[model samples]
Structures are given as structure tokens and as C-alpha cells.
Target: MNPTSPFDAERALSLARETLTIEADALLALRGQIDGAFVQAMQAMLDTRHRVIVMGMGKSGHVGRKIAATLASTGTPAFFVHPGEASHGDLGMVTPGDVVIAISNSGESDELNAILPPMRRLGITLVAMTGRPDSSLARHADFVLNTAVQKEACPLNLAPTASTIAQMAMGDALAVALLDARGFREHDFARSHPGGALGRKLLMHVRDLMRGGEQVPRVPADASFSATMREMTSKGLGATAVVDGDKVLGIFTDGDLRRMIETGADLRAMKAHQVMHPHPKLVRDDALAVEAADLMEQHRITSVLVVDAAGHLVGALNTNDLLRAKVI
Candidate 1:
């Protein structure tokens, strides 16, 4: 009997590197091949009033879900349906006027092909993404977006690495194109991602998170330090707004009080206006909450006065408020 030599670690590492290199090159080649057919595919879906139904089988199904999510988040309404389940009644989820994006590496997944006739009969636009342009699904599609790769990243060229990456990239291209066509903006994206930190930063405004109305910790500029301290303490904001009539004159914070004490400034004789840093930084109620945070950091301050167009103090907010609102 012949004895087999032990596997070489270096050879194994070299093979892995070669696989990745080949797949990366394949994706670059795929990028150059994108043309008018891709545009037609995007236009077909854009023209439809109904949602985009993404369908695939096996590994393609996993990629399809991610593609559907990306499209939905970027202003194009889309959802994923497993091809295998479509035969068992999930096909009902698709409707006429909808766009169907069927994903298959070989373009001949039996499960996905089974639903084509019904989808066609319902007048749903079919766009196929496949490695083989001549495959059955592509031939039946209204438009075919080629996602072909010369080989897979697996040593035996069996795994779906290169194909899956190409499909994902193609999906991203479709989403961005549709987003541009629809005039989708940051606000639209924020509306879709309300639970994310980016969403909070973009969607939250000063008016939404600020302490307003009677809860505003404010004092007349002519008021004594003792009175201002009482208002700040009562409000639990660790700061008080100093105003002359409705105009914000300055702010007095816990830091200001500590500094005054260190300098032996007599609080009993001092008025709020005299001790306050006059003309302190202020933000408008309509400003993005993230901008307020930037302002606070820029001025080395913990709180900011929220004012109206005429410079009247309408609200107040602190770093703590931003933290609580998850805008930090």
C-alpha cells in the first residue's frame, strides 16, 4: 500500500489566496459587462406600481434576502420569497404589476422555474439574474442581468463564493440606480432605519429632545445666584438659561458655579447676568440633533439653548439628553 504524505500548511494557505484573487478578478470583469440590459431591468421594476418580489433557491435564496433588504431600505419596496415554498402557496404573495427578480447561478433552478408560468400569466415583469444568459430563466425573462463568474473561490470550484459576491454587487447597483431615479434622500433613508443610530442622528431634531415649556430651567438675568441655583436644581438639568425678557443672554452651568466659588466670587451679591458667560452658543429648534452635539463638543459645553428664528429661548438641552435620545 502507498503511504500518503501529510498535508502541507503553506500549500493550503497559497491555495486559499489564489482562490480569493481569482474571485476578485471575476467581480471586476463582471462590472465592465454591465450595460443597457441592466438599465432596462431597473426601469422595468421602477415602472411597476407593485413591490419587487425576489426569489431564489438554496444559497441563492440567502443572497436574495439580503438583496431584498437592501432594496427596501433604499426606497424601493421589495421582499424575498423562497422558490421552494412558492409551489406550496407562497406564490400567492406575488401579484400582477409586480416585478419578479429570480436569482439562480445556473439559471435553471427547478423550484424557481416552476413559478414562471403563473408569474407571466399574472402580467408580472420578470428579471432574471443568472450566470448563464442562455439558461431557461434568462430566456423567459423580460430582461437578463448577467452575474457570471469564470470559477468559484473553492479549490474544486464547487462553492458559490464568486457567484454570490457578483450577485450581491449587482443587487447593490440596482438599488442605488433606483434610489437616484426616485430622488431618495437622507431623510428617506432615516425614515426606513428609524431604529439605527444613523437614523436617530438624522431624524431627531432639537424640538423633539429639548426640555420645553415650563420644564425649561430658566431665570431672569437680573435674578440672584441663589434664585438661579434653585431653578437649576429643581429642573435637574445641572444648568439654567439666563434670559432678558424672551432673549437668551447666556447660560449658567454647574461648572460656572464651581469656577465662581474657586475665585471667591460672592454669590450673595452677584446677579445671574453678572456671573454668566454672555452671548453663549445657541441652536435653532429645527437643527438636526447631531449638529447640536457637534456644537456642544466644539464649544466644550454640556448644554445648548434652543432658540427660535428671533433668538428667543424656546427650549434647552444637554449632553445627557442626547445620550438618552441615542443621538450621541
Candidate 2:
């Protein structure tokens, strides 16, 4: 609050760097603080038969929400409940089997502390995430996660900058440990976040986006070269599969036609089998859509024929199909 000092760009930059440095140091210090207590807290959460309820007040509440969300998305079931609301019948949400994670920098937020005794009496496990291990909140807990920072990043040492970061980091640490213990995989994460890009890559199968039946551009092995070109043009997939009784024999593409014309080959007399590229790239109908994308990219091809377990042509898809579905 210097009234006489004017705005200086260098000062602004210096303060920003200082704040980041302080926060970074605080996070690094947290690594050493992770001891038996953290393990105990993780065990308490893992052993719980019900949800992990996160409770906090003020800035700590904001961090708690993110922590709860991260925990939920990563394989743990959790939700944030405001400490102030917990006193007014919201505490009823806490069942006997649930574990509660209470966040407070001072370990003595009046709103949060008010319900801790009742929660303990209700036979729910209490985990205190606090900067002060000796505070009342920590003393009443079944387990304590000490998130103490040496100092606040704020120049006045008043704002909850460094302290909040520590709390969030601690929450993430617990969540990740629990995730690893449960053998959580990307597919599991995708299940919780099905609307995200990773979900599309992991959950979407080739059969989900592939053109099946009549939509598939196909021609018989004995079909004339002109017939192949017509199939490609009509399907607009840039390629056509050569099949015999549903068994894929080969593939013909616009590139193949261009090459035939460039080499002065007789397009008029060629059959579909003669002009096609034999043993073309093929993806299984049950394969992940991202796997199809990888196959196409690796072979420098734009389209791939989809087949079932029996090696019979079931459908087809291309870069456009993947693009349309946002799979790629």
C-alpha cells in the first residue's frame, strides 16, 4: 500500500516470480512431510465402504472442492460439503461408514470445528488436513495430514496463498496414492470422464463410428475396374474394399486409380482384384478407435477396412469418419 510509488513493470514481474517461487518451495517441502500419517489417511479412505466427504470453510473450501473432484474422477467416490451447512441438517449426509476429510489452514475454523465432535460421535472416521498439528481439529481426528507451510506467499503473511496450495497438493497426493493402490487405469479414468478426449480414445470402438452394410464401399474381386471407381465415388470414403463372400481380398483407392492412370496402365480391362492393393491395412471392429487412427497413420493410409474376429469384412472407416466423430 505505497501511495507515492508508481506502477513499475519490473516490480510487477519480480513480485510474480517471488510468489511462484514461494509456492513452489512450499510444495517441495510438502514432499518431506508425507509420512505415516498420510498412509493412515489413505488407508482410512481406502477401507471406507462409503463416500469420502470433504469439508472446509473460506479459501480452504475452494481447494476442498477441487480435491473432492479430483478424487472422484480418479477412482475414489467423494464430494464436498460446506462446513457451515453441515450444522444445519447437512451433517445428516454423513452416514456411519463414510470418511470425512476436513480442511483448515489454522486447524480451528469455527464453522468446521463445530461439527467435528458430532461427526466423531456418529462413528464416522475424521481426517484433519491442517497446517497446525497441535490445533483442536487435528487433536479430534482419527488421522492427521499436516499441510504446514513455512510462510505464506503473501507479503503481509495474511492471505492463504501458500497454505491453500499445500492443502490442494496434499489432497492430490492422497488421491493419486489411492488410485495407484486400486490399480486404476486410463480406461477407468475415461469411464468417469466419458465426455473428454481420453474417453473418446479409450472407449470408442471402430464399430461405433464405422460405416456398416450398404454404407461400406465394396466390390467383388471379378468386378471391373470402372465398377471399383464407381463404388469409391459413391461411398466418398476415398477407398473401396474388394471382398469375396464377405471375406476381404484387398483394397482399391483413389491413389491406386491415379497411379494406374499415371503409368499408362489399361484401366478399361483390369478387374477389381488385379488393380487392388492386396493385404491392405485392416482394423478389427472391436478395436479402439484410437488404435484404428494409429494403424492409418503408421501405414500412411487414409482409410482402413474393418473386419470381425472371423476375418470377414464387417465395415469400413476413414480419417473423415474419425474426424466427424471427433475420435481423432
Candidate 3:
């Protein structure tokens, strides 16, 4: 790579800053242009029984794809169909009751326009997102969202930069408004996204990875120290819940055993409740696994008790379980 001089580096940085400033101003202009048409477009999407089909050409098509994805992920059913492809055979993707969003910065893409007449004849609601309202696509649209920009970020003033940014921002705004209107909650979003780390954090409950039933290291309140140690060793969790039936009385970890030894206590005479930490940090079995992680981290402990709504010792979870579940 050729090393650049300080003057050249400064010029490059200045131009980059100029590009961002231009896009920022473009968004301000676009915000002022939001009128009754934006609301009508939003209402069309809300009222549609079928899905939303987004169409565009060139860079506008790229923006349209992201917009469609945003809408789909945020509780709105939407997809992008290339206008060029639509003209060939993908036109059937547009059906009655579906809303069509056609995007073109210039408001006139020949490929996009070629199929507009047929799409219009289908009686689908047509929404045009363009900078030029007088252009053919805008004129033919049932609703028009003006994405007018003063200029491009390109020094030559030719590339679709500011205009595209404005379109993307408007699309995001629409998606957020629709999301609010639908009362889409985080749990609803978690239901939609149930496969990644995000899904694990939002949907994975403590019971999902917790050791339950016989798997839980547990001993009766009257059990001997040796009995508690055996329970911990047998369960392989390095700890045991000192319980009375299903009700948790306290917790006895290896640390507690070490502390008892340090204190020179008569280990043979001590009961489970005598050496246990009372009212130990416990998590709900039904709570999100992420919440369990938070509790452990906050308390500086490696394991936690998972209890039921009635405060019964229902399960056990540790840092290792969290790692295996990919929730940490």
C-alpha cells in the first residue's frame, strides 16, 4: 500500500466527515417531509390481511431488502421481491390484500415501472417511496412517501448515498411505529428469535438447564454432615440444598464445609441445617436463564438454587450448566 502524506490523509478525513454531515442534513429534510402520506402508508401496512411485498431496483433494492427484513422481524409480515424478477415471473408474489412498497430514488426505474401497470391492475395497495413525486412511479402509486434529498454524499453528486440513507431511516421509522402500534413486547420478539444467543438470554428458563428431581443435590434438614457431603458428591454439583421435603431450608456448599473445618467444629455431630447458609441466593425455575447468570455474578457465586413459586427446592444450576447452555 502506498503511504499517504498528512495533507492527503486530512483531506480524506474531511471528505468522510462531509459525507456524514450531508446524510444527517438529508435525514432532517426527510423528517420535515413526513405528512399525511406517511400515515396512510403505515395504515395500509397495518390493515393488510396478507404480507407486504417491497420492490425496488439498484441501490434502492438493497435498501428495500433491509426494510422488508426489519418489518418482518418486528411483527410485520414482509419480503423483498426484485422488480426485474417480478417482471419475469415473480409477479405472482403480489396478491390481493397484500400491500406493495415500490422504492426508487428517482421515482422512475424502467424495470420497476414495467410491471407497475400489471401490479396496479391486481388491486393491491401501491405505496411509492421516491424523491420525485412527479415521476411516473410516484404518479401511479396509491400513496407516495417523499424521500427528497438536497444532494448526494458523493463529491460528483451522482451516487445514491444521501437519498438511500433517507429511505432506510424512513423505513426504520415506519417499522418502529408499527411495532409500537402492535404492542410487540420483548417476549414476543424472543418468540420470533428463538435460536441464537439472544434467544438463550430471553427464552431459556432456569428449569431448562437446571438439575431437577433426583439430579438435584439435596439432603434433609436432620441429615449428618457426612450425608450432606455424600449427596453433594453423588449429585456432582459440589453443593447440596438442605431441604425439609421439597421446601428449601438453606444451602450447604463445599465452601461451607471448608469453613466448618476451619472453625474446628465437630463435623460428625453437626446436622445439615447447622452448617448451611440460610436464605441462600435463589432464582425462580421459571425465570430467564440470563437472570440466573445475573444473580450469580452479582452475588459472586458459581451456583444458585432454582426454587418454585412456593419456595420449594425444585432445581439447581451452576456456571457449568450456563456454559453448556451457551447463556453466559
Give a tens-digit lDDT track for model 2, residues 116-230: 8889988998999999999999999988999999999898999999999999999989999999998999999999988899999999999999999999999999999878889
By lDDT, the better pick of 1 and 2 is: 2
Clashing pairs in 3: none
Ranking by lDDT: 2, 3, 1
Candidate 1 achieves a global lDDT of: 0.92
Candidate 1 TM-score versus the reference: 0.91
- The collision pairs in model 2 are none
Better of 2 and 3 by lDDT: 2
TM-score of each model, paired residue for residue: 0.91, 0.95, 0.90
Cand. 3 TM to true fold: 0.90
Best by lDDT: 2
Winner by TM-score = 2
Worst 10 residues of 1 by lDDT: 1-10
Off by over 4 Å in 1: 1-8, 244-246, 309-312
User: Model 3 — which ten-residue stretch has the worst lDDT?
Assistant: 1-10
Which RMSD does model 2 reach against the true structure? 1.6
Shift of residue 148 alpha carbon in model 2, Å:
1.5
